[model samples]
Target: MNYEKYYPIVYKQLYYLVGNNELAEDLTQEVFIKYYNSKEQIEFLGAWLSKVAANIAFNYLRGEKRRIKREENILEEVNNIFSIEDEIFRSEQIKEVRKILVNIPDKQRVCLILKFSGYSYEEIHNATNIPLNNIGQFIARGKQKFVKLYKKEGEINVL
Candidate 1:
């Protein structure tokens, strides 16, 4: 029923979180499996599914999977028309941004990542269990912390 409707939404959320196609697909399957097993007791299916997906992605990120990529194919992404030096610089920036995203506090980090991934504030709140009123605050704080860490990362050559 709604599975056909919400599957892509959940999958896209996970894809944005993990940035790896296979992993996102696997995690999305896991989310739906959990939902299927517990569908009766649930009230709001979309919110429940979103929250579960976020938690699973967060747990995966917290583990050794922190080395995960944000894209399925590096070559495909890099094939864009850009100079060698520009590509290299962009690569370094992406690496540093990933590192900073990992280091930020969980709430802030999730908000920033979801927002960056194109989720609306309402969707971010649904997925994160963050209140609508405070989503903006966390996002702002996340950006500040990210900029602060990025500057330090650049100085220390963190990559």
Candidate 2:
């Protein structure tokens, strides 16, 4: 299997699906493993790989308790060690940002993140299932609200 050739392509696709860097990487690994395990049976390798990645990512999200437990374990390990002042400061700022983000409308925040994350208008429309004309308005409004909140409070509205 030419797994190396497909890794970058599949990883990028999976990133949009999961919205988390680390989880996307893990899903990429799982996708390749599925590919290797069923190499002989797959009639279309690319399609099979994508389907498997999507299914696994969806399953991962469906298992929210497992995700939370995994996060809790990682946090527990880190909390056992000494903490840096910068880490503390960053955590507090993150909390504040989350609070501010909660006040933002959901569509606006999603638009902002997708646009800022380098997605094209067409890509945004496709990913969000929104109309093409509405993409620009959503992004424009989202950015305006974000900038206003940032200037007013000196913090990002992110959650």
Candidate 3:
């Protein structure tokens, strides 16, 4: 089987399922491993992998304690990957942004991450199923809130 051919499909599927690139990437790898072992029985390999990944992701999400711990673990891993110093700096910004983001609502937070990560409005719309017009509003509000939070924190640190 041509695993490489389906890699992007698996990635997109998992990304759509999880809405987080890092977690989607991890789940994608797990999905491919399952596919490797069960390839013979799987017809429409792409769909099979997607179903498996979604099931796994959904199960993971259903457990609140597990999900919270997993998020902490993931954030720790992300921190490690970026190096301690860089992680600390980025985390400070992200923490402030997250606090402000909570006030923006879920869709806006998704839009904020997608846009901040460099996706275009169209791309965010496609990925998130959010309306095109609203992407701008979400991003605008999210950015403004983040800027305010960041500036406020910066002022406190300067004193």
Candidate 4:
């Protein structure tokens, strides 16, 4: 089969759907390869090639749409997870707590910060390479130290 004659036409059709010269060229090559690999004897090679290229382009477009939609949904879900007011409140609370966090021992301070930043005990252990069993103890000690320091600071400021 003289497939070279159909290359330009197939490329033009694929380009219209994919809108990329390189991709259209690649798809056109793929179409010819599929046609050449066919076991059945084709009567009209041009028509068969055109039909196959159209089907490939259509399937590609459908899959692209689905992928774009899935990305959009993921972005929307991420945006919904944080609101402006929630962010502001969380920042202010963190600022207040950070004042007391400085007075705590380094290990306890780190564990407390990790816990407040939404890290689970296992996650903190993994990230810090600290033992899983020690994580809870660290967090408990951190919290107790934080409360004591906070009270002391508040009392000093009040006086």
Compared to the true structure, candidate 3 yields what TM-score?
Answer: 0.39
Best TM-score goes to which candidate?
4
Residue pairs in collision within model 1: none
* TM-score for each of the candidates: 0.44, 0.39, 0.39, 0.54
lDDT: which is higher, 2 or 4?
4
The per-prediction tally of clashing pairs is 0, 0, 0, 0
User: 1-159 in candidate 2: lDDT tens per residue?
Assistant: 687888988898889988889889988998887776663777778887888888888887879768899999999778754366668888998886676666678888888788888999999889999888898898888778866776777633332
Q: Candidate 2: where are CA atoms >4 Å away? A: 65-159
Model 4 stretches astray by more than 4 angstroms: 84-159
User: What are the C-alpha RMSDs, in order, of all predicted structures?
Assistant: 27.7, 23.8, 23.4, 14.8
Which residue pairs of candidate 2 clash?
none
- lDDT per residue as tens, model 1, 100-150: 889999999999999999999999989988899999999999999999988
10 residues in a row with least lDDT, candidate 2: 150-159
